[model samples]
Target: MAKKKVSKTIDDINRKIKEGKVVVVTADEMVGIVKKNGAEKAAQEVDVVTTGTFSPMCSSGAFINFGHTKPGIKASRTWLNDVPAYAGLAAVDCYMGATEPREDDPLNGVHPGQFKYGGGHVLHDLIAGKKVELRATSYGTDCYPETQVKKKITLSDLPYAMMLNPRNAYQNYNCAINLTKKTIYTYMGILKPNGGNANYATAGELSPLFNDPYYRTIGLGTRIFLGGAKGHVIAPGTQHNPNAERHENGIPLTPSGTLMVSGDMKEMDPRWVVGVSMLGYGCSLAVGLGIPIPILDAEMAEYTGVSD
Candidate 1:
């Protein structure tokens, strides 16, 4: 008796098949095929990696029917766990209320009695120049400590201005803040302060705080991402207030603060799904691998179609 060796070539295996030519493989075998296909090749290929760092800590909301003329809409933070951070948010379909229809309707039987559409134009209008309060805790401080230090520190008067730099994947836009009035206005323009001029004396000039190298030393707006129970506190409700609790240890202090920061967040807009998809697919092919593609802008635009 002699030992037999199996050949690995596709042609050698095909010759052994029966007349019907049916070949079944195991689960592990199929998995190996998938892994092999997914592996990156060294051949010269265009790599389309998403640029810039991504953050998932920020909160987002939406408004609809902004003006009275248009319908009102609502905005909320988008939850995209399965989608990559660089891929951005997803868009959803919206609709408006129904009205009485005319007797003579075209495509009579084919169409429904009434049509549906999205809402929230009024909500958008109401959000303009509106103040949003965000509360975050500094590390090494217990939120419910007793005998806490209480101070009414004016952030704007701290000899520097604070600016929020959102990811560039979304459209770059300008926002105006009236700290005295606690109002913020968003618009499309250069993000530079002082009305985008060379000099910095104007009301809208970039805050000098950001330029100072020593700003981080005094713990000015520095934040650490805390995971699970001990992390920063993000109270869901609209009210932004900080309260102290009595405990066995010495007085624990927690500070309550508000940010007058504003910027154009259209970069996180769901309408850009189509563009993301096209880029993802193109990049995947260029790299000779099946990369996970994000939803495209066209797809979202289709979902959030014009309101009638």
Candidate 2:
């Protein structure tokens, strides 16, 4: 006997969503469906699987265009609350990284393990609607005459503010533990002496890419929940290694793929995007994100059905 094939398109799923007939379930729920009804039968009943995660994502940042200043100074250097922002683009346009440390920051000076402020905090302040001191300088040019500008700015002050992260949502990562006799501080969080504790970054069963292990349903233009706002996948994330060795079940054993996600920073919720300075690992943003996988076939259903 031949096996039955199941398939559906995104448009078909959208039409179902509009008609209030789409069968949506969390990735965790799909596990039971595949185990009981089998992937083929589960695919016939389920339409989409949703995945979510929240963790420290260092490669996150924002790009802001602060509308041309009077006298139009082409900003060659920029800083926000002592944190440097890359002003390599046009006048008044800059990019601030979440992990970039600030000048006079104790972490860079007297302090070695504890940090207080960074670009991530600056971003958080803006999202919280707090006005931050903005300082800019430029070598007066023929086209852009002003040499400098200083002022307080908020999210609403900028012409455009985009949360353009270069790399995020790592597919899978390491579980760290200290084998030595001494305590150590790491990005995965503080590890106790002699393997007394362990830390891992992934959300296990609720992670996004782990569900669509083969990238069948997620690609460029796929809509997602980013920092509490609706965002889209613009391109393959940085360090996206599709050929990484995988288990027989398709789960990668190492830190493999990553995503370069973007969305409007203005629309993001402050709660969903948090700034943090680790004990020894410096600074980064705790980003919240989610992706919905369309179970177009039995194969996709089987993949999403895998649990932690």
Q: Which structure among the candidates has the greatest TM-score?
A: 2
For candidate 2, the TM-score is: 0.95
Listed in order, each prediction's TM-score against the native is 0.15, 0.95
- Per-model C-alpha lDDT, please? 0.19, 0.89
lDDT of 2 by residue, 224-248 (tens): 9999898888888888888888988
Residue-level lDDT tens digits of model 1 in 1-308:
85332213323324534344434332223223323432122000111111111211122222111111112112122111111111121121111111112123221254222211111111121122222221111122233222212222222212221112211111111234333422222221113343443211111111111111111111223221111001111221122122333122211122121121222222222221111011111100000001111112222111111111
Best by lDDT: 2
